[model samples]
Target: MPPPPQKEPPRSFTARWAALKNIPPFLVMVWRAAPHLTIATMVLRAIGAFVPVAILWIAKLILDEVVRLAALPDTPDGLAGWWHSGLADHLITLVALELGIGIASDIIGRLLRLVDSLLQERLVIDLSMRLMDHAAALDLEDFEDAGFQDKLERARRQAAGRMSLMGTIFEQLQDSLTIATLGAGLIVYNPWLILILLVGLIPAFLAEAHFNARSYNLDFRRTAERRETDYLRQTAASAETAKEIKIFDLHRFLSGRYLDLSRKFYAEARRIAQARAAWGALFSALGSLAYYAAYAWIVVQTLTGDLSIGDLTFLAGSFMRVKGIIERLLSSFGSTAAQALYLEDLFDFFREVPEIASRPDAIPVPRPIRQGFVFENVGFRYPNTEKWAVRGLSFTLHAGETLALVGENGAGKTTLVKLLARLYDPDEGRILLDGRDLRDYDLDDLRAAIGVIFQDFVRYAMTAADNIAVGRIEAREDRGRIEAAAHSALADQVIARLPAGYDQMVGKRFVQGVDLSGGEWQKLAIARAYMRDAQVLILDEPTAALDARSEFEVFQRFRELMAGRTAVLISHRFSSVRMADRILVLHLGRIEAQGTHVELLDQPGRYRELFELQAAGYR
Candidate 1:
């Protein structure tokens, strides 16, 4: 049965205000991303903030001069007469000064936007790099956990989506400065006007804050559904899933599921939007009434001869500017808070520390391992699972010998190999290397010394040479080593068929990429194992896609390559299993028997029964 949709809980007003705590850290990140740009933006905004008042004040001076000249007893009859009388000189100078300030204001605005664009791009790049580095440092187990994935998705989205928050913050700072200057001018005429402005706009500000909280809550609750919809959309059209989707005729099903989820999202968003628009209209009307009230008071004072005409003009203009600036400041404050909520997700992800990091003063892995690994009463279970994948397992892999593990599906063979590589620490007991616990060695050095190619390896969309070099990425530039490894794994033949050989792009993900057959991809995967010159090598069903003849040839080459190094091979084919110096038959996560092929086949046990079953298939 499908799970019920999650409910969107209302975020508290206090919670919204608390999100403000994230702003300091967020600004710190912005500063670190581009310090020079940040400083430039602030300096420009500070200069531009006072331009409006300067323009308004100049207009007042020009108006007062016009009135003085018009009331002259012997006023000039025309423009030529006025210029000759020197009457229009003060008015003309005021107009020219205002024009200059206006132009400078525009230049400053343009510069601010240019700096902001560059700064935003820098911030995104820095955030993405940090996210990648932190994710790389995390444990493999963390990626496998479902909760961690959701946090990761949210963090990834915030890294790019929060660029607008930076601009909003800068605008708020500029608007606040404008408000202070305008409010001071209005206060000189009548301090009551400031009171009227706040009374009218506070309701609208509260309404904006309330609705913004709802919007954030709605988005937060639907993160999982959003991820599901994205997956469905990708699956319905992507190249990797196209063949299977067509074979299963799943396009309609996928589209229908996506539509259903999308409709639900639309319905919820529409509800909040409708409410916001209604309240916004009502509160906007109140704000307009407040501005007019202040205007009426200014006119009354002018008519009573308590103030001059120029005073009325200045006071009215100041009141209107203050009202508009205050409205925007309140609205932007709410928006900034909402964006800060998302910043919490990004910072929270950065706070996540890896649980499996190497201890301080850890020793490096021993070279030319004199003694191989020993697993003593080891047991493990996957996270959030009750059943153990492997338990009570004990074994020794001696140095300079090839060990083959033969088992059916769910026999814990792959789990055992992961433990050997220390991709995961055992939940119980210990795995020792050269008489010391595996945890005592440096994690990176230990992994560097062991080469492992799992069954479900990644098929990177890269050049053919890069595919093999991934096994030992430090040797990526060594073309000779890459070619030798490919030859050893019989992948050279596959690469030679491509138009560009080793330099040819593989995988269908990119344009001009050449796709390979399943067997050919497996051969490339096997080559990665040979690329690493490690003390221990493990191949987990590396040739499962190859034909019997090809598998036989690959295993022959594999045996030759294991000369003085410890190796572990896993294969279902009895032909390859019989070649190992010793084989361990596993059942239900336990070692059922261990011996040479002839010895195991002679015994009347599970190994003989499984071998006979495969033999019967040939009949």
Candidate 2:
């Protein structure tokens, strides 16, 4: 709930340049994504770039010929005379060439767009895949951090939208080529004209770059605000929260919250946009002024007999085209530079390496967990917090024994389970598995040996069988195993009553989905642990929602089902806790007492008080 972390300062020149450097690699990524389509798009664009210049030149020639024909006196004949004069032949050829170039340009344009779209689509899929893979590899702590969530949100946007950058680069290149060819023609007439046009564009280009950077900075500063806006919108409208929203009459509250955040974002956007528009209009006038100045000079030269009508038309046409291309090139360059800053987010997320990675030469977890787990003065506090969630916790779970942890709410029971599973390494002390440092074992192999189901387990909107199969996802298709696990967890009876049996959808997120009662959902979730077939099983209050009778039945079979495996059961229900071989009482992150239920009752400590308190409620 803390405020979002501040973004880094506006990119320095070195950082901006580094961002620009990523463009080449991004282009390389695009090429690798769809090499054939990329090459084809570029080849077509290269062909189309010069088509405009060719057409313009041909039009000039046709105009000059028509003027010459008009000057000649008419022959004795009428229409036939004009056709037979041989002057018409050259005119006809020029017209035909212009028409052909125009047609070819249209065709090439469409083909180029088609190829670009295809390339963009492929790159989107490729980039999204890489994003998901990289995110999956990140540590759990990263996902829990708000700053990292903001980065992920930004990266997701880039994944969906940044593929168009490839097309932008190609278009910029094509426009530059067009400008070069047209400028060559104008330079022959008057090099000063080309220089004037270039000068006119400099102000506009600089203004655009400045505004683009401002916009980028604005967006960077508002990452937290944007995420809040998204969350508010989702809460107001999403299926998951809709029931509560209606029950609490929270529609207006959520709507007001959403509007507040959106208005701030809109105000900031409006300010930046208005400034950009004002500067854009002013700079655009400069370019227009420069163009007209060149126009007057061309007309003066024509009137003084220094230039022909044909030369005047061609020079003016080339100058206009050159001016437009320069404008487009500069605008695209600014846009590309701004987009490169966004690329920093995408690349930065990739640059983050997990701090909890295993050592290169780490050993694998013991197959049977011989000596079980040992916590040697372990202590941990989450990142960015002062208080330890669990501190000075030293305990051992003997192999093949079932240990129960009893504690009040917020006693750090869940934190202990997470530590045991290596979801987090201790900040202060080391944990050992079979006497080897837990960090010394292969991370994946070590996790695969443990199965944990927490109280807030997800109820996936999937088939009933798929829900349970999540525990051992690799064996999801094994029907016999799925049923066996389900039966062991007392969920098979609930599934059997479903309309489609094992294939029945279990949550209301999708159509035709059936919502289950609290106890029934807990049964499906508990089945996951049975499916995992792991050496260590930790049930962290997964049975909390079950009825008392159901709870008694589950615990009655718990020991029999988990005969040889090491187990840890964390629950508030003393009936369940007392059934364990031994009980450890946790209070404020430290074990206040440890012994069997009978021994703890005799000690007259925190455990006895808590037990008597629960017993009084029943009496």
Q: What C-alpha RMSD separates each model from the true structure?
A: 2.7, 2.7
TM-scores of all predicted structures: 0.95, 0.93
- Candidate 2, residues 577-604: lDDT per residue as tens digits? 8878889899888998899989999987
Maximum-lDDT candidate? 1
Enumerate residue pairs that collide in model 1.
Answer: none
Locate the minimum summed-lDDT window of 10 residues in model 1.
Answer: 1-10
Off by over 4 Å in 2: 1-5, 11-18, 68-87
lDDT of 1: 0.89
Tens-place lDDT per residue, model 1, 467-567, is 99998999999999999999999999999999999999999999999998889999999999899978998988888899988998998898778889998
